[model samples]
Target chain A: MTLAVLDGGTYYHQEAIYGERLGGRFDRTIYAPELTAADLAGCDALMVADRIHPGVLRGKRPILLDYLVGGGTLIVLGENSAQQWAPGVSWEFRPTNFWWWLEQGGDPGHRIVAPDHELFRHVGMKELVWHYHGLLTPPPGATSLVDITPDGDPQGKGGSILYDHCHVGGGAGRMIVTTLDPFYHHGSFFMPAASRFLGKLLDWTDEAFRTPG
Target chain B: MIDAILLDCEQSETGAQALITDLALGPRIDLVPFYDLERTVLSRTRALLLGLHSDQRYLASRRGQLEAFLGGGGTIVVCGHIGHPFLAELSPFQPIHGYRVDDLVVNREADHPVWAGVDPADLSKRRGVAGFYGRGSNPPPPGARIINSLGPSRCPVDFDCRPAVGGRLLVHAGADLWGYFGSGNSSERIMPQLFDWIAKPSEAA
Candidate 1:
């Protein structure tokens, strides 16, 4: 279950998250600009971390798509504009309500749509409650794991925050996309929830890769 | 001559991207990608704007070039927590603990053009929520003049340092100063005024 994370070499990515904090857990830190097909080879799970320049990854779309088609799990973090490069992914930008927590009895309105999913076993809804950048409308047959409703109503119209999609188009691989930017905040040493979520999420990614379904 | 060169990392935040777009509109500003810093000529550049998303490791590797630029009287503006050691003059960012809104309040330490039209209260909070301007301090080095402090404790949130013989540094322990844009307050004047201050080399403190 080799895990390879795309490193944009930002201070947050290189100094805080991958370089020091969670450096031991990752098998490879592939520099985003130097990413090639050979870099993805033998990698079971590849994570495109949040805030990586879209232009850097967009050029490697062919390499990434080929990895997915070749049965490699792909994890796309938030705020990376996946819609611009990812096939079948529809992304809509949302103004982040940074002050939502300041409101009386305020909640970010994040809901776990798939509580019974294995990913939930590692991370609960509370870990995903921080503000989000946007919503992802995953392709057909994709199972939405978490969502956020504007009205704070669990049954109200909402957008997916986390989703899982099996590559039914041409491969046995899968993709996990989330609008939550744990890496950015965690790496920046700002949000504690992001750190907790990242630790648990990494645990889940490691476990899921080991027990491939 | 270009007023400043911003190292653009293409950070995904809406506000950051908006700030970049706004800065791009400035006639004398050059927005270069962060990866190209090594090859980008900085001899004639007035200042280097390093954002929260800057690759500090890469900067550290090019410390010589940066020092040379600064030695030539270049001004470098850094925004965000200093997680890694890029310049010897900058220390790692220290986060404030058990902070309240009062602790996040930015106080002026001196009068300067950068802080001229900007209000301290407006920089403290945005729409009633505080801590947007800063969460910690970079801990200014010796001989550096503190421009702004946080709360009564006066933790240095903004300061000016002369790291090299003729270099100048404006370090802020928060997101880029341009993050103040669209706040609907006097704080909006910071980004433009900062560049104006830079353009006036005679005013270099």
Candidate 2:
């Protein structure tokens, strides 16, 4: 099973650095516009950064659907603005709670709602949040992982991180959508708090997304 | 009488378009896609705003057109990371990592009129979160002035420069400049201040 990260090459320097440190598991650091169905044939997991141009990706939707339905893993990262296309994803805008960590007796409203989730392994309160782009509402039946709870908010759910597993055309694949963009922030050395969590998530993607031969 | 034309990178101009309407500059400001920037159009164009998320390679390809726009007395407000080599008289980007909220302190040197009515604290903190001020910087070309800094040594976050031929570049090395989101602060004043300065950069001097 091979892993790859799709980039538009705008953040060239950061992309190179992130591609390097994840050991050798992530081999293909590809440009989004040039990505073809053939590229995903042998790939077990494909990660799409938020910076992609939606027009270039417009035609690639079916190719992506095929890959996921064929039991491959696809991860869509966070966007600072509106994102038009991504399979089974709908976004919601939530005012970011940057000061939750700074309040007196600070509650740090972000929490790991889905404790049983594997992505949270070894991850604690500090690593759970930095600044999220917004909230994501994954399609039905997907597991919601982390919630960026604004201070004292009831219901305790706003879906900051999500994992979707489903059957497509009698085959199954996994899709993970997160407001956290470890690839962007980690590469630039900004998300240091989540460094370990990010490392583990990458390892999990390479392992969990592998399809049987 | 278009004062500024923000080459809208749709993905990056979050809440900024709405801010433009609030300023009543919608009619006077041109919001077009990055691909729409061209010499033929820029001749009649005024100030063009390029965000960090705007396509750099695409803009870099139209290098001559950009220079000419400046020479024709147009202003370009590029808000975000400054790495495009095509932008004249600006140094390559200097990536600034691991900076805390306090690290994004505005310096006395950044007292340019562009920052008028803007607060350094507001620039540093949005909803109590810091560190979004800037993630990197570009070297100030000779005669360039620093108006805001990321850390010591004046690694600038906001700065402006005059190219030899013409035009001025007000580069804010951070998210799109606007204060219109739920949080109303000094950042909200940036768009208007920038519009004012772009309208008359000499007065800002």
Candidate 3:
């Protein structure tokens, strides 16, 4: 399966996408500003990661929508504001608790709701412990994979940290989005969990491409 | 007078928004997208502030322009790990393995205006949590004044390098220095004092 990753040219994106660990996994790395439908041809999936300028994505919205409608997968990572560029994605901002783990009997509040899902077959709850940017409520037909209880609520009322949306753009394609920014932490050499999560996510995508629908 | 030209990567992250807000309130820093640096006029600018989220690969590709700016007596302050060889003097960031709180300590090596009245302990921890300042080292260029070091090895995490033939360069191997704004601590002194230091005429001048 051919995978195309958008390159924002940021140091973190450069290291995460093209660095030693997962560089060989990507089939293409298109410069974000110059992205066109032609640039995504023959690729099974295109990933839009964190820290990409929303303006650039807004400019390429038409091309992205076209790709989605053309039966190609579009994966958007966190902190890029999917609502600004992707179709039918609703994002709401919430204050992140970066110091939750430091609190007494504290919990970061992340859990894999869809534990049996193929995406979590390799990556697990332990790998998604870092703080998230916000909550995502995708349009109907979206499946929430990861859920987080806001403010460490004992009631467990929260939003999805990761989700998979089907029939996006009214096509056979799909979009997988998550508010967790693994690449930023992985590339920064912080948060060992981010590295493990990213590596496993890449493996999952590659495996998904190989399996016939 | 303009304090500096911040290379904006246009990210919507909280830290990025905070930096933007801080600069907007000051109105002295010009926000230029990283991609637009090639076309932006910089010869007259006194300093360039490169954030932790900057596109270092793009910066490396446009190294000539940056070198020219520095050669023309322009300062460049970079905050973050140097993953790519963007500038000749910078090396890739090396992370400390199995580090302790002491390793994260901010050791003041020399006095400078940018760090005036800033307590090392305050810079060392944020809200009683340590390791928020820095945990790695971006080896400074030779002859650079080590302003702050981290860990027992005294790895240089912050330094001021005045290349023999160019203006000054300040490198901070951690979060953006400007993000410290409104933190109600001496770290808050960094943004304003940094610009003040940049505006001052060098001894050569």
Predicted structure with the largest TM-score when compared to the true one: 3
Candidate 2 global TM-score: 0.80
Candidate 1 chain B lDDT trough over 10 residues, lowest sum: B11-20
- Top-down DockQ ranking: 3, 1, 2
Error of 3 at A178 (Å): 0.9
Could you give me the TM-score of model 1 versus the true structure?
0.87
lDDT per residue for candidate 3 within A59-132, as digits (tens), equals 89999988988898988998777888888788877676676677625566676777788898778867787777
Fraction of true inter-chain Cα contacts (below 8 Å) kept per model?
0.54, 0.15, 0.68
Model 1 spans with C-alpha error above 4 angstroms: A14-24, A36-41, A102-109, A150-157, A210-213, B12-25, B97-102
Clashing pairs in 3: none
Q: Enumerate residue pairs that collide in model 2.
A: B110-B147, B179-B188
Please state what fraction of the native interface contacts candidate 3 reproduces: 0.68
**Residue ranges of candidate 3 with Cα displaced over 4 Å:** A20-23, A150-157, A210-213, B13-25, B203-205
Chain A TM-scores for all candidates read 0.91, 0.78, 0.92
- Docking outcome class, model 1: medium
Q: Is the docking of candidate 3 incorrect, acceptable, medium or high quality?
A: medium
Give lDDT: candidate 1, residue B21.
61
Q: What would the per-residue lDDT of candidate 2 be over residues B1-205, giving only the tens digit for each residue? A: 5776666555633665675675475666766665566724765555787766665656677888888888888887776554456676665566655566556665556576656777777766556656677766767777777888865756777778888878887777666675344346655666666677777756533
